[model samples]
Target: MARAVVRAVSASPTAQAGGQVEEDPAHRTAAGLLASHPWHTTPLGVPGGWDPALRATIELIMGSPVAMSLAYGDAYTLIYNDAFATILGGKHPAAFGRPAADVFEEAWATPGVGDVVDRVYRTGEPFREAETAVALVRSPAGEPEQAVFTRGCSVVRDSQGRTIGVLTVATETTEATSRLQSLGELTGALAGAVTLDDVARVALRYGLSAFDVDHMTFGVDDASGWRVVRRVRGELLDEADERLPPLWRRLPLDSPSPLAKAAGSGTAAFTEDGTPLREVAADRHDQRQRAMAAIPLSTHSLRGALTFGRRHAHLWLPAERAQLTAAADLIGQAAERARRFETQHGTAQLLQRSMLPEHLPNLDRFRVAARYDPGIDGSAAGGDFYDAFVLPEGRLAIVLGDVAGHDMHAAALMGQVRAALRALALANPDPVVVLDGLDKLVGMLGTGTRSHELFVTVAYGLLDQRDGGLTIASAGHPAPLIRHASAEGQLATVGYLDVPTGTPLGLGGAHRAMTTALSPGDTILLFSDGVIERRRRELDDGLAALAKSVAEAVSGDPRNLCALATSAVAGATEDDVAVLAVEYASTPSRSATMNVPPEPTMPGRVRQWMKVQLSAWDVPEAVIGAAVLCTSELTTNALLHAGTAARVHIDLTPERLLVSVQDSGTRGTVTRAHTDTLSSRGRGLGLIEELSDAWGTDPTVRGSTVWFEILLSEDRENP
Candidate 1:
């Protein structure tokens, strides 16, 4: 039998042969290998001749408390150790000389063991898990229970510095694991709680009961009134607790309260000698003076206070203050979220009413209906509006328009334009006439009044039911819809050709056109641009929708038709919208035909119409000369080329005069040409091209209409 002896980890030891040895970091590497790698019988790697003394020392190392083994190739053989036989479950000691994989195959299957071993093999880094679970073999009829382990690792090396195996040492950690579980449960109970009141109760019950505290309370500060959220009292609290006032009501947001200052600065104010209570007494009204600490409960802008007090004037402990300070931060986070929620709710209400009308008008023919629907997803208001009133001629002048933006500024501009349009229209009954007048007045309305170009698009109409007709005009506005009483009534677009109507109000245009037609029924549809402007679709799609809705609702009264149009547009998208629908009692038929008489030469008729248009446009005498010359030349072009029936329609507005010729011919493009030697016949077309500011052709089902415009002095003054 080979005798075994144990030596201490230092250079010398005093262990008898065949007994246990104390394990420590210095020799843990060699001890772990001999215990697990049980079957090796190679010569010791020490140099032979000079280390006989060391070889004898290595032999004596075998008598340690740990199991002893050696491995050669794949075979593990137990060398000699009393501890080696104890770990074999019920197997006899004869089982010692076997493969290491076969002996501990079940142990290798334990969770987390394989991963640790693989890290040591691949990266050569010793990995340790603290308080990890492990399984150990027992006697017969036994079940495995979890056991905690602290593990260490080291790489085993042969003489050439090549890794041969890995060594591991593990110790039980069951007692430490149980204490950690209890601590986690207590912390979780405090973190998951809500409400300052509940938080105070939890703090008092757990913090005071465990730490033996006298009092605990939570403090909060915000825009609303500030107050002490809670004050704890118990059986001994009456005697132990300092007689403290309701601190919450006394400390307001504006006051210099200790909790408010600590919360605002996000700094913990702690003093064992009652410095916090003394500061509060000096700055505010506090009767009691005892040991107090303000644990700052602050996150972002929300502040929370955890104030402590003792019935006897004893100083607070540092450890206790530190614990409360951490809890204060958690409380502050919850308070911040609640404060933000309350602020957002208030902001929503304020923005909702910002765009609504300050007051409604009271006019005889104006039965105005207005509706404002703010966006559900945080948008306040967009620009849409309607206005109406009885003009001097008893005709109700109705205007509907949209400013181009969708903010408070857009809505404010919308209101200003709407009120201006009504005032101008009331002073002048012509829709075209009123708009031209407004164009001149825009410059006088201040720079802030006109913040953007192309600020608005409007459709204005003057309804003179006393005369049984409506004069309609537009400035880049959607067309007014007309529905009749017939069963198969198709929605008709009533006005004639519309030009880019004076460049959308704000861009400095000289004129707007006023076209008139007899109202065919009791209903007329007037709407803002939103009725025919939709996203993800062409402009034609909105036009088609308006026509379809009007045709569907034709048989219904004006109120229903208006409702149908609004519903149709509103259902399609989220956008600002305004509409005005006026209905009058049905009237009997008027005289159908106008009496015709023989007239003079076409030049005379054209000249007379030009003067009438200039008067309506309110053009000064200075610009009338150019307008007269342009109108004459256009009429001559129509009479000469098409041999067509010609109708001259001249519209006079306050800003400019427009003269158009409707001819029975196809649209012909005009060319800029050199003037010929003053011949009367051909010079007319050249002169018209030169004198007119701008002109174009509108091709319709009947034929083509060539039109020209002259900028009047009125536009120059106002625009």
Candidate 2:
């Protein structure tokens, strides 16, 4: 066992109460404090009469660099080096010569410090503590922060070999402990990353914060070659540059490149100046950015590099190097995990798509458009699905649903559920009956297979084109949206078709059908929860956003509406998104015109109006193509030149289709044509004449008229 510090020094005990004693000049300040105190009234009277061993021990410890504190002569009087005064904080000068117990009256309750001191003094035993947390007034503001210390205690003795007091040596460990915690957090963040990209993102983010470095880079080998992500002062670089994956033009790492050297040898590389990497520098402006260090990310199957740098020159401390090493190891492990997940998910996704419908029914009465987008992890599969098909009696059936998983089981379950729903719908056209059967099937599957995640949310809709009747049912799914618009340029309206939301599949609950009649150009949209579920926003907000996007699109054509609705939001799709849109077009339209407002939103509103008019008329899709385009051109011209509201008139007959744009402008050609993509007033009316069978301009009663006509095709088509 360790014993208290004892320095050999010759000192004879002073017999007189007021006799002189030897002292070191360099340490006189501390010695003076001892001398200035009223020792005459204390148990260990005047310094002159103090024991020789105590005097010699005090003299030796007072001038030492280490933080040491000791009590002596049964009074357990306190004495310490200048370094130890900081540890005492507010309890220093007054505690100098008092008994340790009296000075540390409250602290005596705490273990490790006071108890260890007392035990050592009483039993002549030595003790050491690896780490002890003590609350101390460590700042000038008299506030306390947790301070950790490694302490060693031993009994102090005098010339007679009898115990005097306890000596304690303490070294602060707060900084080291904090570093350890930081490393733990980084490891956890890396452990949670789900993809190679996620791993790189977390690694760079943590490295930037933890190391406080000016530059960082993460490189990995993947299907996209040896790709690297670099950031300067935490700003990601080479994002807009197409040659980003490699980050440089060079095929292989150069001989002198810090990254190359470190990765090649599986060790760290350090450099003072960044000139060695100037050849592969992102640009000339950052050629001299200081180089700090580079470490390799290595595993048996994968190898890459993580490099860090600062703007100013600095050397890596041992502790800092060790921290970087640990961080690199975690990133490598995360990369490996990401690889496995991506591979497994890719296979699952292929299976998922194979199970979904390859095509929607080509119904002549209404247009159908469906789309399925897997979540942010593209390689991963989800349970979301969308399907549209014609029933035996000619009604169109649409289904959108989500299963509860990201694995193969969920995808397979989604396929089975979709097929089962279709089968039941063919037998019975009632939306309520079809969904009830699906609910029972799911409940049985969960019980039979003992699957933890067999829950499903589904919405089913059946539409009869004859009466524009649409019936919808839900099993805890988001309500479908119905968008209605007028061909006369009225504002399009979109709202949820409030269907009774019952318990999710596997949980038996009452399912009810809501019947609603669609207007001439109404579209019903069915979508999975992924379309409305978001990480940063509430489900209500996402629903509102979807409704707003649908309202703006308002294209009676299902395809256009589907495209716009899916493109409405930002960010990666974190869940599977499935959408099915079916527009009602039972009534045949003959003639219609939509008012063109003179505003920035005019272009989009005009498109929706024309789409609504054509769908209401059940106009052939092939015939409506360039006609819509050229009509938009004429309206924009009238709005630009006449500077007044314009009318887009669509007149269809058995033999031909005619469209005219009229506005209150005196000129035959209200506006000059432009060569811009948005305003296809295309060079002149000459381009219009070439596209249509014939075109001409005439003076109307109020202003002017630009008209075009095309021979209708023999075969009718649907979009």
Candidate 3:
């Protein structure tokens, strides 16, 4: 049988009759080890007498460059190339001729390696794993450490197609895999940052965690010099001993420091000694850093540097330096973007403020307050605006409007629209008529500008002090919210005034005005769509929230109401918000009325009647003097211009005293005359204008009324 087996082995293509063929030269060391091994004392006989399959497999293993090994027979005896010997760490020489189970006893117990080999041998199958962790005794002291490896195992078969051994090819991947994962996390953290401070916080946190550094500092180049903006130290440092510097520090730009050099040259610099940085340290005694590296960061808007320190005198590897450089670049780009955004935001705020009304006009019958909040970024001007001004005939005009876009063009268009609306309101007191004129003007404006498709939504209203009635006209605008006390005197009862709205301005349409009677202690709110618009929410749901908030704050002041409405809704939308609130006072105004004949002495009679009323009202002498002069001038003009009997009316409030003179004559214009030294007839209107705080005229159904106001001092006595 031995002779027959030998003849069969000799007849095989891979074997000779007396011994195995010479091994390939590519794996000389492995071939030499197997040739000198004591295989006869173990599972297999001498190498020359081995089975043809085993001999062929050994020859292939000896010729490969990868870390490959073959475990044959039931005992799983190990045979490997010289390349694989390096993977065994300290056990290389002794494990060369031993069984894989004995050489890697601790690793054999792990499922990814030893179990995979056993299964492949038993089932005649193949298995592969990438970045698999195996606990192996790689440390010099025989201690096990978790090492990652990309491993492949296959069942080796004999010429008769019988499974004989398991073949494995492995490449250690512990260092490279860790590096890739750390870089991925760092990139993700930097991508979400939105501001300079956010960038600093995220970069420092991730850098410290990923690099395991003792300390880190970030510096950026500005017009003045390079400045340190952020710093962090290892968690192991003593809290009492680690005294950080102030939040910011200026470094000499032309100095020999690593940060300055790195930023100036746009390259990385390193130093094993941190004595240079320690020289300028706020707490010199805490200079425990030994290894330091300054990496450059550059972006379109900024150039900066990042410094990393280690407590031990360890040299930074090339891979580590490359990773640090990459992380710094991401941080620099993000920070530059944030800086540019902030600059734009500040400019937009300034432009928007300039476009909107700075102070609402103080009126006799209404308390007005307004607020405007831009979008989250605040980097673009929005088209929302509000205005409140006193008009003729004891009426106050309040306007809230929004243009179609958010940009500089929209803001500019808003200013033009607001100015047009004010000019139109002065000519036509009716809200609907004023809106019609505004629509035509806005249409004309759009046709001449690049924003021809832009439109404006407006809620314009007029409040009559005579009867506390409110007349509102909407041009594709949200209805005003009304809050008042209930019949039982409970405050904060709220309701919406829904009226038919016309097409927005710039799209010509006839606007209809709606009238509502307002009682004392009533409040009205007008707002842009942003006030009730929210992300992923129904418009009605947002409106409900707005209504609930308004009802809760109805009893508060108009300023507080505007604040509440804005704060409640501004955070929920990216659009701009504008809110206007008006609260009607409860007390009726005090007044005195008299009729004057169209006589040359009418001015004297009007002054005497005003004096009696002033005395009864306990008006201040200074304000009374001014009021009498204004009344004399206004009544005299009404008589001279209208040629009709003048009806004089005086109304007093805590803030001002108003006088009105009505004549049953055709409406006439009032102009401030540039009176020469010899002129007498033209000086009266100019004198009235000079003596009053504010004055204007309004035409009535049968006549015209000229009105003037004198601001009362706080010391004036009130009835």
Candidate 4:
């Protein structure tokens, strides 16, 4: 008991006149009397509702010694005793029957009261006890202190319940008593805090130390009532006096202690020491704390209480009690923040997993490893990718390219580019033909208008197991670096960078593509600009660096070359880089250069050659007549224009049957319909146009290769 007393004293500020609420007892009583004279009365002003007799009765009652006040209006009047007028200090007797704002100008002008008055007037509903504190005058020697009040006001209604005028009442509470009650309840609720235990502790300590409480604790609620979760007190309560009594104990929810009331009712309480201590297990020694307050922490999932035990009966003040309420709010916010963090983190992880690749293809004679690295900044998913697949021909086609930008839209475009590239490659193995087909697929270019600049740089090739080599072509993309194992167990460069070919797949023009062959024990590395090139370095410099790296890595084993290159560029490359390499074990043994010897004869010469080559390539006799006519027209056009040297060449593979006519001069386009005119002598080009499926020209530095192609039959048969 002594220890609890000491604790309470230690927590509380020294009692003085200038505490949170200052008492001016001598002036307080006089102020009330001076404002209560009959001269302060004013007559009721509304029509039949304001009866003279009733007004007199009301005035008599108002003048009595009651704590409440009343009023009526159009012209707002004061129908109250001196107690009411004393609340409006320095007001004259004539202030009655005046507007509320005029009489209590200083108070009504405050922002808080203005908002309250607006609600009352607009809703026509009572505005109950609005709390406020004010220090009207400064002290001569010490800090001025607040005088606290709780006000309730409403409209008075007629028989029909229609609002006729306003009525008001004000109540003054013991500031210390109210604050102690509020603090106890706040801490009681905070005791059961889970995520906010730290916040709860801070509130409890502040309540006990700053509010002069003898013993204070936050406690968790259970069926048994409140269990002390945290407690702070002075030496008395801390003592080990078995005979005296235990100061702290868990009480049943139904017990008449403040903690039990707070937990069961989920409400706050203020009680005096004199209240009967029914069902309390504490003895007189333990019950020495004369004042008590408990506030429930019902703001979160857990239930708890802030319980206060004070040695000095009236330790809590209004300002300290408000502080406890604020502390409880902080604890609730912390708990909510923790919950949100966990939920969001889980969602982010799920989204990332859904976007990653599910499986990678297995290739023969080669070990392949692919890596996708996202940008480190706040960028989302990107558009860089590498893909490889087998063509109908035995050769493997590989590709790597970037969409125009980064983001979901760019990733989507990357997919479109990849799918289109694969389809075109399979349809026609020639890299230039595949890209030209893509332009047609995208709906940009047509035979009539051939100037659309829509383009993407790509490098594609067919890996030939028959020759142990790759026939590769490029469309404005970086050349693949070729590395081969030398006889000395060292690596060396194998091929030069293929020049930009056939104006990237999308652009339409009369352009030619070049092919390079790879031999046995060689690796061809295809990559995007992200690899090899740094911002400060030109493409040639970047390519040189890549060649050096590949030559060294390919020396020992081809299987780990991919992993090695990935690590090398991972730090050096800032953007997405994709690398795909194909190496063969044995080299092919033959080389053939296809060249068309100059043709001299006109229409007849074309007819004979087309028949021989088409038969050699096993073109069916069923289409032999059509093939002969197509060759006749193309060769005739070449003969008429060049007139010196023109020839025809034919090649057949499982994918396509291609025909090319070499001529000496750079000539204009051939329109077969005009050539087939009634009086026209040139029926050759017209016959070729009607017979072939599709045809175009490859404009070369020396001359153009006028060519066309036909898709092979299902069995690739001559029949």
Instruction: Say which candidate scores most in TM-score.
Output: 3
Candidate 3 lDDT over 1-719, as tens digits, reads 11223334335433322234454552245554454455556676555556544654554455445566878878888888777877877776567657888988887877676777788889865666558977888656877887777666767765335667777766686445444444434433443444455566667777787788867877777666775654556333332112211134456678666677888899888877656466655443227777888898776568788888777786788878776876776567656655665578667877887877766866656767777878645678889999988887668899999997888888998998898888888888898898899888888888887566887999999998777798999999998998884442244788999767888997898899888978877889999999898878888987888888877652434655676687665344768888899878665458778998666766887888888889888888878887888778767656645555789987775556777788875212221121111113325556666776566554333345677777565544351
Looking at model 2, which ten-residue stretch has the lowest summed lDDT? 1-10
1-719: candidate 4 lDDT, tens digit per residue: 11222223223332111123233442233232222222223344222224222332232223333233444545455444455656555453435445665655545656556456556655766565446775432222434345577655555443223344444545466444334333323322222222233344445556666566666765555445554433436533312121111122345566666666676677877655643233462444345666677777654445666766766556455665555544444333333322333244334322332332333344444323344443322134455667767667556666666544445654555666777777777677786677666656543532334534334566766666566555666666776766765654345655555645555545554334556565556666676677766666676676666666666652422324444455544235556555666655442211112333333334565566667666765677746566566666666555444333565665443334556676765222222222232112234444555556555553322344566555455533455
Instruction: Give per-residue CA lDDT, model 2, range 155-179, as digits (tens).
Output: 6565335566666666685445444
> What is candidate 3's TM-score against the reference?
0.51
Model 4: lDDT to the true structure = 0.49
- Which candidate number would show the highest lDDT if scored against the true structure? 3
TM-score of each: 0.33, 0.46, 0.51, 0.33
lDDT of each: 0.48, 0.66, 0.70, 0.49
Of the pair 2 and 4, which is ahead by lDDT?
2
- What lDDT is obtained when candidate 2 is compared to the true structure? 0.66
In model 2, the clashing pairs are 589-617
Model 1 C-alpha lDDT per residue in residues 1-719, reported as the tens digit of each score? 11112123111221112234454543234433333221222333212221222222223224333332332222322233344444444443434434444555556566676555555645656454556766645444466645556545433333223344444433354333322222222232333232333344445555455445565556666455344533444533331122111112335565465666665566766545544455444322233535666677655565666666554566555645544554454345434433443355335434433434433333332223333332322234466766666666567676777777666666666666776777776666666676776665554453545444536677777766565467677776776765544423344333222433554666456555555444444356777656667667787777677767766552323334455566565334446666666644343211111111112246556677666655555567656677667666655555433334567765443323556676664212111121111113334545665776555554333345566665455444454
lDDT of 1: 0.48
